[model samples]
Structures are given as structure tokens and as C-alpha cells.
Target: MPKEREWLTFYDWARTYGNYFYLSILGQPILVLNTHDVVSDLLEKRSGIYSSRPRLVMAGDLVGFDQAIALMPYSERFRQLRRLIQRELNAKALEKYWPLHEQESRELAKNLISHPTEMQSYIRHYAGSVILKVTYGYQTQPKDDPFLLLAEKVMQAFSMASQPGAWLVDLVPWLRYLPSWSPGAGFQSTAKKWSDLHMQVINGPYDWAMRNQGLPALAKPNFVSTVINQTDADLTEEEQSLLLWSSASLFGGGADTTVAALSSFFLAMALYPGVQQRGYTEIQKVVGKDRLPSVSDRKHLPYVECIMYEVLRWNPVTPLGVPHMLVEADVYEGYHIPAKTIIMPNIWAMLHEPSIFPEPHSFLPERFVGNEAAVKEVSVAFGFGRRACPGVAFAESSMFVAIATALSTVIIANARDMQGKDITREVPYKTGTISHPPAFTCSLTPRDGAELLSIRT
Candidate 1:
């Protein structure tokens, strides 16, 4: 009830009143689940009645994202689109994309060697390029690209719309019908402008590929052409429109979250030089510098895997797992849960459990090694139930390839000051539905004999 950061608020609430609590905000009943067991029981076990999303009038309907599967309500359409995405991004399917992952991530490492200060941009390019290539078969030159700029635009709208009580129209549905100039009804203009931007962001790459008409010669079959140009494709106009939205959602889901996770990875590397050194030693043992780290090496390199898990647990991008709406009334632990009640998982608190992670706030990949029960789970970072992130396999593989390749090639240390002393700044991260580190500086010197993974590899 007090005015504190959401993480602090959720953590405090969980610690004081146990892992579950109920409250009313803006006349809406809300349930927050913080522990792993309760979340597993309700969101995962009773998924049949907990898969729908609460109404997001401002962020989804007004900002024109309702059609995106990530925001779409649970329905036949969402199920179909999710199946399509899973087909292309599931664990087995993601193997085909490994070459692209390897290429882009190595490119990021090379770019960092020359421009260490621009590490953040390089991470964005790697993620955006991979998703765009897979979803639309479009290659992004990236510099001054309007589409890249749109990713920033998406984040701005996303951050604003996700903030509770930020827009009055969300609370009062009738305000949506108010004229653009009406008093106490400015959300109309905001929605209209964002709607146009959202459309362009989703459709731009597909439009470019269509107009180019040389899509057939591209390196691979992208989601856009593969679906719209199918011999069996006889879609109604509405079906086709939804298909377009679904294709874009692939990039929407992967790009920002990947950026956040990767940025956090860098911050982790910077703050813990000893950890980086230890990880580098493991990399050399498993993956020789003759070639970059590949997915094939994941099994042999347990420390690398531990680092990946630790990064996700240490600072998950989605602190409060995406809100879900109850489809029917249910009872849990003797408490009544009414239909339509909003459910949110306090992912931050669960991931930060002091019992599991001894020094919950500390960065220690070793906590995940040799002990499953002693360590907090990392899969929850992807969410839970039928509405869980469909891009989990694809996203995990993307971050893995990127972090593994980058770590193998670079010495990521805290940047040095003009006087030649090590400079350490307090790590600061932005809080929202999507979390990310603010701009921070780091040093990336090439490792011994660490040439770029040969282009021909």
C-alpha cells in the first residue's frame, strides 16, 4: 500500500504476509501469487481456467496491439497463431536457425572489439536482426533504420501503457469514446497516433519484402512468405490480417526481452570480473578458441549453462509475469478466487528467494550448479500455463548463442577512468513490464587469439 518500487513492494508483501495476497485497485479484484508452489498449482496445474488475459484497454486496444498473440485473449485465433509460432520456434525447429544465431552473435563480439562503448547497440542489432530475418526474411542494415527506431517507439509506448494508473481511460471504459479534444479525454489522440505506429512497425518488413519481389531467392523461407504464399493458402482477408499481426508478434516478443536479458548479462559480467574469468576458463575447456561457442557445446559446458540460468534468475525481464485473467471461479488454499480476477505472479520475489539463492541479491552462478532444489528455477522467467511465452525455446537459444559467443571472445571489464583506475558504478536497472539496464560503460578487449569466428564457419 505504501509508495515503493514495485520490486520492493512485491518483495516486502511476500516476506511479510506469505507468498499469496489479495487486494483491490481501481475497483478491480487482483490476486498476486509469489511462491513457486502456489504459482505451479494455480497458473500451471489449473491452467484450464487461468489462461486468459485481463482487459488491457489502453495498451492493447488503444495502442493497436490486441491482435498480437502475446496480448490477444485466449481464443481459437490465439491458439492457431501460437501453433504457427511454435512450429517455427519450438526446441526442434530452432536448430535450423542456429547458423543465423551463430553469425549474428559473433558479429556482436567483433563489433564490441572495435567499439566497446557501443556494446548495447550491437546487442540490439543482433536480436532485432535475428527476429526480423526469421519472421520476415528481411536483412537489416540497421544503421539509421526506421524499423530499429520503431523498436524504441514500441518500448516507449509499452513502458507508458504498462504503468498502472498512467492513463485514466483504462479505468473508465467510456472515456475511450470521448472526442480527441474533449476535456479529461486526451487518450484518444494518444491511441490514434500509437495505432498508426504499431501498424507500421508490424507490417513494414513484410511490405518491403513483398515489394522487393525477390523473396524467393532469400537464404531461407521466412514466416511471411511461407504462410502468405503457400499453395494451400486460401485465407480470408481477415484471416490474412491476423496472420500478418501474428508474424510481427514474433519480433515483438523476442526483440525487447532479448535486449533486456542480454543487457543484464553484460552488467553481470562487468560487476563480477572473477565470475567472468571463471566462465572464460570453462569456455576454453569446452570450446576451444579455434571456433566460437555453439549450441552443440552446451552439454559439455555446465558453467556456461549455469551462467545462463543465473542471469535469467538474477534480473528477469518480466518481474511480474504477464497478467492472466481467471476464466472460472476457483478455490486455492481455502481462499476463494472469483472468475475474471486478475492474476499476477511476483516473479521477482520467487526468483530472489533467500533460501534458494543464499545471497539472493548477489550474482552467483555456482548456486545453480549441482543442486536443483537449492536453486530457484529459471523456467518461470518464461511465464507459466497455456499462456506462457511461446517463444521460450527460441528466446533461450538466442540469448545462449549471443552470450556464449560474446563471452568466449571478449574480456568484459568495468571501464577505466581517465586517471587509469578501475571505475565501478552502481548498477541501475529500469523497472517495468520489461526491465533493462540503463546505459552503462564497459571495456571489451579481445581475448588471446580470439579472431572473429571465420565467416566461412
Candidate 2:
């Protein structure tokens, strides 16, 4: 458990210690599973006893996020709550929401063409608007949306609180229960500030839906409204509260992670021109210039699909999954394991394993395209077993359509400086549980006469 931003240093330790290792941090035991096979065997095969989450005192309870589906303790109620999210986000259900995705994705291409310099803002807006509309039926403002800012602020606080040893109170559970005035409890103040904003995200949309329930013609159907309409009499207060939190996790889980990966997609396009050109050619031949790409085009454009996989493989957003807590003790390879130990999957190490992926360091989609059989496994980056992200189908659809449309309509190039030389320097990604490509100058130009339609459409 490193306190500093050098958490990836554990990757070096993985090289020396082999895939699996156990250690004790401040008297708390931790099991680090690094290889894909071991993670599948332990976390996937033995999910019954490994699906619980380690109690995050500061980030969860104190910040009013304990109710969040991702942070909730392993319980039947939480499982049911997550199932609700899965029902709405599964591939079949997501098709009904394609109008939302198609409209925003088209806006994404137009936004890139209109504001080439602010790729970060438009990328975030594209992802956020999709989730915002689907989950809350709320339309997003073009820039400086209040809801987007609050969500980012709340999400930022959670990210800060999740560092290995940033908050001592999280390590010492008793410290979290102390009064607000207690010394060394500044985290409580910080948590309150974020939770206040969190309340708006949690209740604002739900309450709006409740007030507009009867007027079907005036109402904009969304996830919150759908859940409310189907279960008003059957749902207990606790169940309703669970639904609210699970739905709000869309912004935290869906928007941030999706936006981060899409940003990496842009970086990859800039760095690997040949791969980008091939992907562009594939999109051109399949979809042509009459219209922008759509979700239906994904199956025909396998190379573009490979680019999405390679982007995720190259830079996983959550390298170390939300830690899993053990519910029972078991021995693996004759080693003694104890119950209640925290299980941490080193996803970065597994995805970068050279034996599984030749030239793993390179950004090559051909590795996945050439051998489809080897890649036929569940995604570990989103998570594994029962605790896997419920939004995988929805997320992949969002990335696929956006990438396809962008490739068909734009050319991602290196920015040029005053001397006419490309400013091709790259910055290191910020260190965190959720990582993103650092801000860099990149030139985005429309492709041919077809892009003129993109601008007007």
C-alpha cells in the first residue's frame, strides 16, 4: 500500500514476486492477485466468498456514498439494487436508448469539428450527456453545466479519498465515528461538503420525476421514472433509496471511466497514424459518406472494434479494481488464507503480461484482431465475477459508436507550433485509481466533403 502516487511500483514487485503475493499493511492482511489466470480462478471461480467490498470509511460512509452500489457491502439488498441497474443497462435494454446515443454521438462529431482545441470538454460532454439523459432525463448545457461541475467535484473527492494511505481515519475505523469537532477529523468536513452536492445528484432528479409522474405526455421517460412507475407500491423506502443511489452511480461509473478511455482513444489516434488510417478506411468502406457511423455499423467494422479493445487494453481506467473482501478462508497452492482479508486484483499487471500479449507495451490492435479466440474472455478491467460493472454493455456501445463516427469524419493530428514543427510531446497520466490521458495539443481536422455534412448535420 503505497501512500504516494507510485502505486504502479507494485508492478515492479509483481515482476520479482511472481503473480500472487500476500502482505500485511498496518495489521490488515492483503492478497494481491496479478495474473489473469489466478484472478479468474480466485475472484471469478470463487466469487461466492470474494465479492464483498472492504469498508471504505472516509470515502463511503463519511462522504454519504455508502449507499452507492459499487461501495455497498455484500448483502442481498445490494445485489438486488445492482440488478436494477443491470436491467436498464444491458445490451437489449440499451437499444431502446439508441436515439439518445445517436443524437449525442452525432453532436460529438460536430463538436470535435467545431471546437478542435477543447477535445477534453467535448469528450466529457458527449459521455456525460448520454448518461445524464438516460439516467435522469436531463439535457446537458453545452459548457459549464452546474450538474456536470457538481458531479465532477463529488467524484474528485471520492478519488482523493481512495488513495492507499491518504486518509488515516479510513485505516482506523474508530476515528471515523468521532464527532465533527474532533481533532484530525478534517476529512469529515471534506466529506460533508461533497455529500451536500451529492444529495442534489441523488434526490434532485428523482424528486423531479415524482412531481411529474401523472402527466405521461409531459413526462420524459428515463431510468428513474421507469423504476418509479413499475414499483411505487411494492418498493419500501429502503428499496427506493437503493434505486436512487444506483441510478446516480451512472455519472460516477459511466461518465468518468468512459470519458477517460475515449481520451486515450484520441491519444492513440494521434500516436499511431497507421492504425488510425486503417480504422478510418474500414469505416469508410462499411458506412460510406452518406451518413455518420451508428451502433449498427459496429459489427461490420471489426477493425474499429479492435481499436476500442486496444484502447482499453493499453490504458485501463481502473487498473486495480475496487478491492474485494473475503468472506471465507481458503488455501491456494497450499498457502493459508484467512477470512476477511482484502483481495486486490492487479489488473495493470495482468493486462500487461508479456507472455499472453507479445510486445505488450506497443499499441497494436492487430494482436487482438489476428487472434479472436485468445481474447474470448470476460473483461477484467471493468471487474470480475458478481462484482463486475453492470454498465459494460452500455459503456462499450457508447465508445464504439463515438469512435466509429469520429474515425469516419475527422483526422486526429499532432498540433503544430509557431516553427511549423509538430508539438508531439506527451505528458504522463495523473496517478490515481482512475487514470486519464493528460491534456496535450492535438489537431482535429474534418475529413473531405463528407465532414461538411457532419458540420451541418
Candidate 2 — which residues are off by over 4 angstroms?
A: 4-7, 177-183, 214-221, 232-236, 415-427, 449-457
| lDDT (Cα, tens digit) per residue for candidate 1, span 81-182 | 888777777787678888888778877887788788787788888888888888877777846567877876886677667654456665667778888787
CA lDDT of every candidate: 0.78, 0.78
Which 10-residue window in model 1 sums to the lowest lDDT? Answer: 416-425
Cα RMSD (Å) per model?
2.7, 2.8
> Would you estimate the TM-scores of all the predictions?
0.93, 0.92
Residue 443, candidate 2: Cα error in Å is: 1.1
lDDT per residue (tens digit) for residues 13-41 in model 2: 77788788888877778888888888888
* Candidate 1 Cα errors over 4 Å, as ranges: 1-4, 212-217, 228-235, 373-376, 415-426, 454-457
Separate clash counts for every candidate: 0, 0
